[model samples]
Target: MKKLKQIVNEVKDRIAEQTPPAQLTDLLWQLICYPPKMPLRLQQEQFLNQAETFSVTVHDEYFTKKDLQINGFKWGNGKRRVLITHGWGSKAADFTELIAALQENPNLEIITFDAPANGSSDGELSNFLLFVEAAKAIIQKTGAPHVVIGHSFGAMANVVALNDLHITPSLLVSLTPFILLKENFIKSMTTVGVPADAQEAFLQDFERKYSIPASYFNMPDLYKFDDKLNHWLAYDEHDMMLPYSYLKEFLEAHPTIRSRNYDNVGHERIIKSAQVINNVVEEVNKAIAN
Candidate 1:
């Protein structure tokens, strides 16, 4: 009787652990704590809906962090290729202005697609691993030398992917990457409504290994990163989501990463903000020049 009860309890525990990503998404939406009437423009899609005026479509390809393929179009024929990756819950269209800005330079070939779950892309439940694979596959497909600009979750994934997957690029620009806040993540998750037990288990798995399967801060070779990686992060000091202090470690330790700090740009706004767009262009140009 005692053994049976113990087994039952363990099964219950395991079952409780596997919650839906949507629950976490909802909790995160609630936890946003930002008092903006509407930080995200309500075009319907996760920023992808806003870019419909431009010629874009679903990328039809099998994608993982190491392998990404999509039925997408390229805007320019320039020799220099620049790929833009959107943050979590965002689609390929998020880089509209960034792509336009790069196109003006005449040296850039702009390529972008919806990350797995965000846009018209084929998959669901996108996380670090899938993003990294998609980015790697996209880079390989381009053939030409490239620079990668990743925002938020995408940014963190690219850093690890470049290191782990060996998808080296001419330059890497990261905006609002989230990877070091071990504890605050729980608070962030709580705001999103993740059950207490699920969040705990996720963190336990994340921390059990030196390089958690997670996208952020899992670089076993941070020491090897050179000067070509530039990180552009926008954090409203009062922003409720992330701690800029802990985020600084990625910038400080790596000899190669250069960063820009914005005061009230907040999280979502900075990815496509005019200043961020401009900064990203400048960074890419600098790398191309080098």
Candidate 2:
């Protein structure tokens, strides 16, 4: 008997061979925009159950071009509001440890929400653009926060949202962020077994549909908005998703931005590190103080 994995691959190959290029292009878009949704784990649910839950609507003029509602949670009734955004394919409840650490601040009203197509959000597909829209909508509803904490693509999306909305938090804590959208997309294409020609076609379709070049989403383009914004960047030396060198150039360019390096931790594990949590807490305190 053929292994289940082998069968799946054979089916995918058959689909690719039989499907028309236009049809295949649409499928490629779906593949990139929609990642498998991860349900909240038992511990995550337990943690979120203790907080006040609600929903907010994200509005956009293109693509979805409609109001999409996403679920959110608020912890504490403190004066300072802090917003937290989770990474791609990740749900809001994944920040349990960070939430616990931030809860130490009596005056901090921390907020976290599931992005579109993630967790309890009402969607089947999502991209960085959608994530940015969601973040902007939440910020608008919650008002300006004291700090914005984001993990991986979540961090990049939040930065883009802040730039577009002209909202600047006192501090932005970015964990394992990537600067080049093109590089990320290339990696995604390779992971999904997209051929080189199909990759080009995908980019063309993306640009045509969005009316914006895919390259415009790069870190340099997004960060052009606010040079005055304070940043607290933390990344692991061993992070496989985003190489250390990609960020080193940006860090060196902006010496004022505070950064911390984790010795043994990788991308996802760094979030659960107590030391990382402590560093984040310290920055939150500093932001609140200022």
The lDDT leader among the candidates is: 2
Cα displacement (Å) at residue 264, model 2: 3.8
Candidate 1 lDDT (Cα, 0 to 1): 0.57
What residue runs in model 1 are displaced by over 4 Å at the alpha carbon? 1-71, 165-167, 181-185, 192-198, 202-224, 227-239
Error of model 2, residue 82, in angstroms: 0.5
Model 1 Cα lDDT, one tens digit per residue, 1-290: 34333433443444467645433433332232111121234543343432323222234332232332343446677788777777766766556667777877887777776665556555443445566666666665665346877777677667765676565677777677665534455665554345676666566555453356333443323324666544444455544455666566655676446566777787777766888778777878888887
**lDDT of each residue in 1-290, candidate 2, tens digit only:** 13323433643684578655555676666666765665678899899999998888876444477777899899999999999999987888889999999999899999999998788887767888889889988888888888999999899998888888887788999999868887788787677576767778878888998898788887866785446778999998878888888888878877777898998788887789999999999989988988
Q: Cα lDDT of all candidates, in order? A: 0.57, 0.82
Residue pairs clashing in model 2 are none
Residue 114 displacement in candidate 2 (angstroms): 0.3
RMSD of model 2 against the true structure: 3.3
